[model samples]
Target: MVPVTRITIQDVAREAGVSVATVDRVLNRRAGVRSDTVKRVEAAADKLAYQPDRLAARLARARDYRFCFVLPTGTNTFMQSLHSEVEATAARLTAERIRISVRLVDVFDGLALAEELERLGEDFDGVAVVALDHPAVREAINGLADAGVKVVTLVSDAPGSKRVHYVGIDNTAAGRTAAMLLGRFVGPRKGKVGLIAGSLALRDHVERQFGFEQVMAREFPQLEVLPVREGRDDFEKVETVTAALLAETPDLVGIYNVGAGNRGIVAALEATERSGEVIFLAHDLTPFTRKHLVRGTIDAIVNQDPGHQARSAARVLLSACEDTPIVPDQERIRIDVFLRDNIP
Candidate 1:
């Protein structure tokens, strides 16, 4: 975990090898501060990567930037990790005069999510939402932008909106990668491939499905893609759906779960005594997925760094609030492909 980061005068003073008073005087442009001391203090602050907002804290009304993370309410292990990372990032940034809060919403429900986004309006300086690509949700995000609030889409993107930035992996690329891996893994086997997701309403899932089909149609025509099923990333729902899929299609040779609930799929496979018979590819390398990968129950896992996404979302929102230039490379989230040999 990242340590609590507070760039106060004391930190600058220590870095500058000067007393607190000297550093404070230098920062405040007060008299009695020597030129060399001012130079040292400025250098130390720069080296510490301190934000100008720290100086703004001296005013009668200090600037406290508040950011909101609108995440989904689910038991998905990946979502759980993302929620924890958000909280950790919030704690690490609290000392820097940043206020971050996470709000749980049914991201699968377009209207409900839109209502929540609309309710958040101008209350927060910036908002990072796990946005669904729905007209209502996009309208709500634009509403926030029109109200002078910065909006960023997190995890899943709501395109064609007034959002200033997006923080997550390239879903289309991830999907294509999954398709190639699964296709090659089940090489020469002519059978049906089942696609599962939390919700098709999510732009990420839809893009993944699209990309997967594109590759399958071009390179892996031997495999037939079944109509996708939505499990809401629920274990029970996924288990029931998987059982149905497996029962209905005895020739189910491959499955690509673009969302969570890998455990349910694995359990269903185990119960049906088809654990090692079918090729399974999943998203997010959580403990369960990691174990399954190592045990050869799961062929591959596509993952995005939850911690990096959380930190990037915060940094992007802060930059937007300050009108500062954002470093694209610093905020770009990488998609990781983990197999059994490279479980780490």
Candidate 2:
């Protein structure tokens, strides 16, 4: 039989330079103790090699640990689909003794997202955010990591930060695939193409744009891609901008929507009776886009399963809590391509 080890709360109290009552408060998570004092007690316990029994700890604690989900609030079909998936996943997780909180913010406002991220520091054990590539948001994620919270990014990622991992499709490759499809669809044509983007402030949009432009410039030099028109993911803005581009460039034969606002694009094309005139390729297989694909309005769609994204993101947080290794094959998701014939 192996030898058993013994340690006492009094020993930890002495090592931490605090009284036994303070140690008890820290261990039991009692009220009225400052955070600094709690940190000191935890450090002392670590130094003196105090290990509490796992079953006893669970029995003593009543509050479930929390994980947060932050994303944009929008009426767009894609965002709505993502929100529904996350809510379903959150409900399932709650039954397993975990608490999940969902927060929605406007996609156009980086300041609001940063503020919400900062406020989550004390309330959650882990966080998963649809991050923006901005200094203020980066700082907020770093602060959460510093305070022992696990951070993960979903959909669009914020690289070079303290994010533990990312859960989404490879966006660059998706863009390249879009270019290949459009280049092939518009065979032997010599006309300019128009690109509609959600927002350049997002890293994913920027990367997709880069991949699309590189492919067009190298292999399809006959096709000139106009400067990206910022849609801000708004229907009115997308329609107005696309109409302006159509008027300015009579030879525009194709359009690639790298972000949201497909509804507006469809409406604008219908109004001009050019619904089937331009070769349209877009992202995401939301219900709206699915119908459009069936009707021949959209030629192809590059999709990342939002349901898979939510489930994988939740599993990452649970793995962090359990101190387990994540399986790359299981967590690394795929980007799917949907054509009219292959629509599911």
Candidate 3:
């Protein structure tokens, strides 16, 4: 076994160019420190991979924590899965004195999400959000952090915000993986390709699209990508868009739905009798996606485990509450690729 070396306050102080006293004050939640100095100390602690002993902290003082999970209210399979995982996590953590409440919001509305974040008030000690990359939402996160509430971004992220951590897979790598799978499955890559996404405004969707395009340009030069359609995770909207795309591109070889709404794509393909003709790739392996995968309607489903993400996010928040250290790699959510032959 590798010998472990505990990170000390002096190390954080050195990294932040501050005194050990300043680091101790920041870690202990003591006052008499500038805001910038506090950020520096926290950043240094994060960079140094500092982990406090949670067991000792618990023994010293036990406290009940109120954590709020802000989720998008929808029938979308992935959202439903995330919701279930959050509920289950709440139950699992209850004996530890963690109270979790799942709050639903209109996922597509950034203004509404911002308003909801602001309205949370002092009801919860910490908040975990499936964030939209919007300025208003970022402002809300900053406001929450300012109020001494621990915040974590779940699944999606507000990249430049003050959120403590982002619990999700590397979406760009996921997109690239999808592109490689699509390019190889479609025997001759010399046909028009199409891409569908909820919105390019979301960081995950944008990163996935960027990674997909990069791989397609580098490895599959013969395939041409068409302008992406904003499916908005709506079945009817995606169905309409897919139908239009099919009508327009006679030789479309493959299509990757980078966001939600695979149900709509399946519906359109089934109706058009083109399910077997074109290679389809999507994210999330839900019951709908599973059935379609088994039927060979979707060639691959790039997946992230909702339960794993929920558990990791909760653990991270709980650790933060006690000023404990977290293992970075342990919190990483996996990217799973599923096919008809390998449906797990």
Q: What TM-score does each of the candidates earn?
A: 0.84, 0.82, 0.84
lDDT, candidate 2, equals 0.87
Summing lDDT over every window of 10 consecutive residues in candidate 3, give the lowest-scoring window.
53-62
Q: 1 or 3: which has the higher TM-score?
A: 3
Error of 3 at 136 (Å): 0.2
Model 3 over residues 1-344: C-alpha lDDT tens digits? 99989987678889999998888899889999999999999999999998665555554565678899999876567988999999999998877678899999976789999999998858878899988999999999999988888899988889899989999999999999999999999976589899999877678889999999999999999999998899888778899999999999999999999989898999999999999899999999999899999999999999999999999989998877777779998999989999899886
All candidates in order of TM-score, best leading: 3, 1, 2
The list of candidate 3 runs beyond 4 A from truth reads: 1-63
Candidate 2 residue-wise lDDT, 1-344, digit = tens: 99866778888999989999999888867898989999999999999888655444434567776899998877567877888998899899765667888899875577888899999999999999998888888898999999989999988888978999999888888888899999999999899999999888888888888989989998899999999999988778898998888888888889999999998889888888887779999999988999999999999999999998898998898777656678989999798999999988
In candidate 2, clashing pairs total 0
lDDT of each: 0.90, 0.87, 0.89
Best by TM-score, which number?
Answer: 3
* Worst lDDT 10-window in candidate 2: 52-61
- Model 1 C-alpha lDDT per residue in residues 85-127, reported as the tens digit of each score: 9999999987777889989998988999999999887679999
The predictions' CA RMSDs to the true structure, in order, are 6.8, 7.4, 6.4
